[model samples]
Target: MKRAYVLVTADKMSIRKAAWQCGVPIQTLRDRLERGVNQARPLGGDPLLSRSEEEGLVKHIEYLAKCGYPLTRKDVINLATETAIFLKKRPQNAGNLSKRWFVRFMSRWPELRLAKAQKLSMKRAKATSDETVQSYFQELDRILTKYDIKNKPHLIYNVDETGFQMEHTPSKVVGPRGLKLNAITSERGPTTTLLACGNAVGTCLPPYFVFKGARYDARLMAGAVPGSKCSMSKSGWSNGNIFKHFLEEHFIPFLPQRKPDDHVLLLYDGHTSHISIPLIELAKEHKIILFVLPPHTSHVLQPLDVGLFKPLKTFQNACGARMRESPGEVITRYDVCNLASKSFLKAFTPINFINSFRKTGIFPFNPQEIDQTMFEPAKNLARNHWQTEGEEESVEKGNMEKLNQFFSSRLPTPKEPKSHPKKRKVSYRPGGVAITEETIILKIRKVYADGDDAHIHPDNSLGEVSGEGRKRANVTQEESDSDDETDDVCCVCNKFSPDGLNKLNYLKIVDWAQCDLCNHWVHLEFCDRRNVNDIRSGPYRCIHCVSLEE
Candidate 1:
């Protein structure tokens, strides 16, 4: 009896606390003792369930109670009263299990993980329109409608430039490994430069500007092509400089020149260079109305942006690989330009380019007057090796022929015999022309107050006069080194017109010998460009520089 007392208190912590923490129901504790105390971890009486199962049931009951689920008196008893009873239509002869014990037993194995159960696939979101793209379409629609222009094929011209470098390109294409990835190495290869301009109607690819250097700047853009030739200035263009160059040199030329009743509309995407202040100003001056495509839609809207650039790239690579210089210098910008120019002639004939658009499937070309006009605007579009047809496709293949044909024709035409660049007299003060023992030191003490209006420069050259068309007085780099004495005379402030050049003394050809280095059958600076003279007095390396260079 004394040993049994320990189980009554020490064995069950909850029971012990329950007994003293709150005044015990005197009869209840005595009733539990008298009923039974057989479980290993004792509660006051029959728990009617295993300890693990009871713990789980406890959690479930608490959650349901907190969520305020309604419960009947019987359900409450089944939860907390621990009645180990089964009520499955039991008859009087069914074992010794009580109805109460079955209730507790059935509820014991609590399935807590299934508290908020449902199938995963049923939880997907309902369909809805994305506001992002919708807004863009709205804005675009407003613009097109406001301009009173229909959304059709040829009316819009989308232009841009793509680059081909001596290095990596995107896309995992299978090709001739050696030929596919050509770079400027010790061997010669075709350098590539492609300047392109296109719209859904079609693209205008002009003569590619190929040369020695690779770097492209505003000046180079202006120089290789004339401001007049390229119709260019201050800013860049779509495809960067490519579009600007193409538009100025090629596109505009093909386009019918503007007139008073013209209803032509020029549409483009807004690249930094395209919408530059200078470009805008130029557009205004040219009387052109430019419409810009919506931002992200250029992918879907622009014809060239969508499919043409890819094919354009393929031909550029093939042609560029063919331009090889024998192994010393890397292909320069001019080389790329040259290759690109050649590719332009080959890749974008009226037929080939038109065919490319046709193949793209989504092209908006229409047979209706409104649609077809985009492709063939003018009635008498030219036709020749250099001249493009309503659409012309070259049948030529390979390097020499493709390039030589396009390049030769694209070169600036030789000026007429009278339209040659006329030179103005540079007022060289003949400053202190002293004949010292061996050298001549001409230090003219003229006041170059602000160095403005003074042609004399640090290289001891006279300033340039604002000739007929160029802005900012220029010093003719060609004339500086080549002043000769014989057939050439300095007609105005002349001073022998430098060293080797045929002076513009008489508006005609002053027959001198040949330019040895350039081998141009004309007057050159030195007796022979091959000879090397001493350092103290520089030597004329060519027809003009032997004396001037010295």
Candidate 2:
């Protein structure tokens, strides 16, 4: 086009000659120099939305999708109509966008691809609140700036663990209509946990696999991923000891050597397994700064969780599928290593890690990546509307009440079954005679008295067995009649008195032990004996339960 312009003006060539020489149309050459005309060809037909306006709409749609709000076909039409109204266009045609307009709208935005929506838990969506995410990003930015992690991408790493079900969910297959009870061969097996660590530059450390067993199988490790390590746990889950060992034996060894003054930053979740004192101390020794992500916010915050693991799991399942296709081949733990190595190599590309870090607003430190809409779903439950034939109507009062009660209000408490007056164990098993004739008469009377609105508080003394109610039968005859208040019972020892009492109540602050799991209160002395090396300031659990989980 530029050559044609030179030939026509500077060379004084005819329009036809220039067109022929430049292989351009004469009309197009004429329009190129026309006064007060836009150089680019106008899009065919007048559009309801201008180019910039449509771009804005596309951006809004993308934002909603990022926040996990799926837009349906009607949603897009409504959005377009709303946009037209905002632009002060006549509402006649804009009020109801045609199918033709929708097709053209989609064609204009090539980047906006229609894909299946991913399900996000309401709890997780609520946890990723703007305030919480912003605070986390602020703290993360402070640390990254202090360490200058952006310049040293290799030194900034994210460590996360994920578990894979050994069996692959069956894919859709061609079958006759109305077919049911499809029998399919499967390789059902236990779960395996993979602990993966990767840096912003895309390099990943050797992954560690934790399996459920008392002993390690050499065969299982034979064909495993390159540089991958394997260990055994009772529950096939990562723990403080395993995490510490991975950092010491696998992670620290692979880290690039640095000067005495230099330190690397490692990001991980604040799970009990990842925050042990030994792991923290070991990291400090190796000049590794451990940064813990906020609780329940890993879905968006952690680089691995945000990017690497989903594809890794998909590829792992693909590998299993390929194995299944081969005759006489049985997928086993031994094959997981080799198959996983292939999947990891394909999934854990350097670009994925880098993009994940950027998307999470960690490497570049953009705190505003997440907005308020991420929490909108949880903040407001879906409104109910009654659809009759072809028209939508507001929900009726009764329907609205039922929906609101189901979603936002507590359920009605069930009436307790009656038992014999004499203290005895009540069998609640099916076919057991737990309710008596007298109790049935009282129940009928209460139901008739209250009618449909019969209600009882869930925490009422009559509804639930209180601590006092359970121990009343065990109290001594003389003690039961006494007016003096009894000491609080200990949850652990099942005793009615505190184990130790320092007479100087003014000088010492007495702290009662609270069990995080059971929510039971116990004597401080008993908890101290149970957890000898407790350092956590928040909720503390009994040693026996935590030890079993570990």
Candidate 3:
């Protein structure tokens, strides 16, 4: 329309000719000409921040997100409030930062998005410290250079598994304020694991899915991609056997034809199953070199974990949501593979694959890609430890004694309660089995009630009671004896002797770290020896039950 008006006014063209040539109305062209150079009016009212200020804000938020501390909506609103106060632009009508304002604010910044923050434990955070990441890169660089696989983009691949819930609830929804709204979902079901493999150059192999069942039905693969395969596992998790099967059956078969001498480099996490003899044997037989990521550092190092999986999960949820909306549809295990196929097609793009590799410094090797700020928390903690030691050393012995004296004077002394003697004698049952605290308490009550057979022995461990004992009156005997297990075993080594007992005096003192996945305790030292690194900073898995991931 503007072009037609320009032609009519500037080129001496008639209205009819201009309208016919430019395919616009003559009156519309005339109106545009009269209006002069049409300017795009700002849709909403003047922005709270100027263009430069908004740009700076976007940069700041991005920086914070990179620093592992993405701001919440409330945090962003507070920051805006602070900015308004700083700029002396307080509007009388404005109360809290409006939701619409935030929506518009995000619209202006396309690259800046609201993402669900990944929660990291302090141990996990420390595990991804700057030094650890740099070490990983150094080792990766050495390995790539050593094997001359640095330029082998196609040969360099990352494989990771992710789980998709049958009824994947969307992250956000619209609802009225101050009212409860539950997202209606299908029946509760187990997640299906999807094993995805991709190269640094953006080539993706068909996904391998593991479902929880004894047998897989053909209907499960109905809408799946042509070459995709599905397997069944008891827990729907991958084990060494499944991993070996995937490498031999799916992975090796999907690779592009190459010379017998040409080998591929496969990068994966330090899951015990991945390092098993059978998996290693299969990889070696197929001329695939397995490079295991350092323990607890997959979040930053693995290409699939760093980038691809997040989008894949989001897309899967979207697919599940679409499936759910169909009338009378309830998502079952069969529907997941199809939903996953749709998600993989949408999310596993070339850009996502390549970017993940580049960002993690795996391909086109560059260690500087990882920011130093990611390791700040670990460094700060180390620094504070030494500083705390120095301050403790600076304190005088005399001052410490005086402080102790003052605390002693102020502290209330606990008094012993009066005991009621009875004719009943408590009995001692001797056995290798644990005599429950409940049994002892019952015998004590029997003695106090003047029961003749209840005799309390002086050698009994629970013979004495204190003033604080009354506080535990409501505690059940089973609850009291909960910690008296004589046969606790380590999940990894499956041994009992040094497993449950905690004694610092032991020559080789061992601490038990519970697997987050299986909720079974394994010896910390045993985990270290077995290369199970996440035991310390965990959401961990035992060797036998390590994730196939869903």
Candidate 4:
């Protein structure tokens, strides 16, 4: 078509001659020459959305994904449907855009692809920022340089604890398609805590086990590593006392002989159980440096969390599966030790220990080893909403405005903010601090001056102390009792009226009615009743209760 048009216009040839020379149809050539239009209309019905509208939608999708809120196939479909309605291109009765449209949309934009998103907690995502990680590395470098252990991989150690339940998580197995498959596991079991310590030089100490019981049992250590240490805790979880004991008894004994003044860098997360006056004092006494990773960053910064614990849990689950092959066998706390020990031996190899430290950028002291893309999710925390900048701004803004207006107008009004209980105040400590004699002395002074005996008494677990020297359990019980006294509060607005009168307007008596099904109190105004007589005339049911009946 271009050849025919060029021949007729540029070459000054007749329509018949140009069509004959270019092998084009005479009628088509005549029509094109007369109309003087270069491009022909696309060979199909018009698209539901214009090219600009589709481009805007694509930008919106990419912006959401970049903000760590990627849309699913159904989410895109619903979004498209809503967009079409807002633009008045589709009627409200039109259903969601089909999967075929989604496939074509993917093809239209080559940059987009379907992917499985990994789950990360909001706190973890927000905490794993470049600022937090860089600060941690800065402190870590100071400790390493001050102690002259940057070249000594044997002196750098990471300690962490993981839990193992008697009931194992089943792994995938070969089975017939379209048929249900089942893997046998214990019905219920108690969790056992395992504390592991490894160095950057690919060496590990004997695994330590903490079982749930008042008294320590010898049988729980059956089939465990030869030099493993076992202890009992009320909740089968390590506390400050257990951690202190592990460092003093197991960790120190297993260390290779070195000068008394040589410092060992012990890296671990800042769990309440991992920090105490006694633990800090012990570290100061021994030439060990206790370095805590930034809060909520263990998943990326802690060596054990980054590389070892995942495989350790997987291997433990496999071992538990084999043990379940025995008919009518129920794994006990005794079996947890055996299964965990097997997994620990497999996972805590020299190569794995070395890889764990390297992957976390700790062993080689290379802060640049961490991937920048891992911090993308945290970028959204610093911004209020996703903004399309650069070339996409003009294209996306108009459509986004319409869509936002449509949804905002129809969405229900937000509920009134409720008052939250006063949270216990905790003293903030800088991460990656090296516990030295001077630091320990300052901490002891602060504890005594502040009357914070929780840390001084290792037997008093963090959960027991309310940080204000009051029993946490007693405080919680009192709060619960106060909550029970407010049972007659309105469910809709959370307003309370003691004498059946509105607090805002005493003359306007607001009668409260209880739902017969849920037994929740509701204001007559919220129940679609103009007067208290209408509510008392019949048994009241809340909207949720009515929906449940349907």
> Which is the leading candidate under lDDT?
4
TM-score of each: 0.32, 0.53, 0.55, 0.66
* lDDT, residue 32, candidate 2: 74
**Each model's Cα RMSD:** 34.3, 20.8, 19.9, 14.8
lDDT of 4 by residue, 495-547 (tens): 33332332344355445566776667666654444446665678677665666
Alpha-carbon deviation at 85 in model 2, angstroms: 21
Which one is best on TM-score? 4
* Per-residue lDDT of model 2, residues 202-319, tens digit only: 8888878877777888887776766888777755656567777788889988998787877788887654234433454577677787776665567677788777777775544565
Q: What is candidate 1's CA lDDT for residue 127?
A: 8
lDDT of 3 by residue, 34-108 (tens): 676443444347897767556545555664565455788887776766566555676645666878788888887
Q: In candidate 3, what residue range of length 10 has the lowest lDDT sum?
A: 474-483
Better of 1 and 2 by TM-score: 2
By summed lDDT, the worst window of 10 consecutive residues in model 1 runs over: 120-129
By lDDT, the better pick of 1 and 3 is: 3
| Candidate 1 segments whose C-alpha is farther than 4 A from its true place | 1-154, 167-194, 203-253, 257-261, 285-287, 319-330, 349-550
Query: Which digits, one per residue and each the tens of the lDDT, describe model 1 over residues 1-550?
Result: 2233344566754544555545575456545566764434434555544464344334444433332232344554444332222212234344454556545544554442224321111001110112322443454344345444444444444444443444323334456856855344323322223335554455453544322233444443332322223322111111234444454556665664444534334544443223333343444455444555433333333445444554555533543355343445454433444444444555555555455444433233321211221212121111122222211232333432343333234322323333322232333322111111012112222223433222332212111121221122111100111111111222222222224334445433222232223222222223333322232254123333333335
| True-vs-predicted CA distance for residue 308, candidate 4, Å | 1.2
Q: Lowest-lDDT window of 10 residues in candidate 2?
A: 476-485
Q: How high is the CA lDDT of each candidate model?
A: 0.36, 0.59, 0.61, 0.70
